[model samples]
Target: MTVVEVLFLLLGLVAAGSALLVVTTRTMVHAALWLVVTLGAVAGIFLLLAAEFVAWVQILIYVGAVVVLLLFALMLTKAPTGPQPDLDARRALPAVAVAGLVLAVLGTTVVAGFHGVELDLDGAVVGSAQTTGATIFQQWVLPFEVLSVLLLAALVGAIVLSRGTGRRGGE
Candidate 1:
């Protein structure tokens, strides 16, 4: 087994474990923290695939900004910070079975698709930053602007929701 394979295996395990924690944790804050870990591990996986720009963006956008905002909202709302109830083994068993089936199908599809493909790691890593920046601004500027607007809307919504309803027009 190669070093890359080992890294991938370890990172994948971390990502999966954190993702499960995110869903299973009772406390909202702990779930958000687990989500951050999962997002960071995904960023590491992107870096291992020689996608530094994407990895940094994942960390900056998802782990840094989104999760922070989510936590802030949770705090503002005074969400319950208690231990979770026990997982229903009956529901969990079916859910796990479905998840496993989906994973198997996706894995089979990816492996079959890339069975004969050869990727050049050096080329993938070289000059990627400049090209990625240019591509994002040039090709995806519209979507980028739209996402900014969406974020602004989300922030406004959070603020509006946090405000109490007992407000007067002239106070």
Candidate 2:
């Protein structure tokens, strides 16, 4: 197809591979790092799709804040950073089967729904900041504010819990 399609496919592959790594990696820290890679790849895909606002938001919110929050929580908790045998031994077959089934159904639905529809990228409006801001502020104000408050609460709670634990494991 076009160059953009090729780049989109490549980015999609990168995102999918790293997302699998995020789940399958034995170490918690490594998983978080892989998630960063996956999110970055997704942002690249959004950029290629000409959604500049969304791409930057993905980079800022997910890659910057969420991943940093996860990493901070992991470090502060002193959780195992290495592979754990008991965790490794948990049954994965059922999960894999379920994931495969879901993928198959979704893929089929997408193909069926979009079989003949062609996108007109040349005629589409560029995703502008003013439009996006207006749309969000007008339609999604409550949800957006609620999400912000939730993230703030999570950050506060993590800090408070970390501060409360003493040297004797809070005994």
Candidate 3:
């Protein structure tokens, strides 16, 4: 096939593998780090699709903010640094079955939707920053503001949780 197709396949493999690791890893910190890999792979796929704005946003929002937040929360909560023995392989079969089922559904839907269809990339500017920004501000402003508020609240909650109620020496 084409080089782009090969690259897309590679990125998809990376994303899928990392996503599996994110779910299976016993260490919380390692899982978060694996999530970063998964997100970075997705961003790379976005870039390969010529969606520059989406790629950058994926990197910034997911890899930068979300993963960092997860790591911070893990650290603040004093989570275990080693492999958790409690997390056994008992759910592996069920998890794999569910994943396979979802993948089958998605693949079927995609094939049906795009059957015999070809994309015309000429003069297409859907992924441009200007277009994305205008759409977000014009039609998605309320949701954007609500998400910002939610993030702010989560940040505050993390800080509060990290700082325990016990008084310090100065107090």
In TM-score terms, which candidate is top? 2
Ranking by TM-score: 2, 3, 1
Tens digits of lDDT, candidate 1, 28-143: 78999999999999999898888888898899999889999899888888877776475335468788889899999999999999998865565565326797889889999999
RMSD of 3: 3.9
Clashing residue pairs in all predictions, respectively, total 0, 0, 0
> Residue-wise lDDT of candidate 2 within 69-150, one digit each (tens)?
8999899889697786565547889999999999999999999999999865665666667778988899989999999999
Q: Which stretches of candidate 3 lie over 4 Å from their true place?
A: 120-123, 138-171
**Candidate 2 Cα errors over 4 Å, as ranges:** 138-171
Q: Give the Cα-based TM-score of candidate 2 against the true structure.
A: 0.79
Top lDDT prediction, candidate number: 3
For each candidate in turn, give its C-alpha RMSD to the true structure in angstroms: 3.5, 3.8, 3.9
For residues 142-167, write the lDDT of model 3, one tens digit per residue: 99999999989998997888787786
Model 2 is weakest, by summed lDDT over 10 consecutive residues, at: 161-170
Per-residue lDDT value at 152 in model 2: 100
| lDDT of every predicted structure (CA atoms) | 0.85, 0.87, 0.88
Alpha carbon deviation, residue 24, candidate 1 (Å): 2.4
Query: How high is each candidate's TM-score?
Result: 0.73, 0.79, 0.74
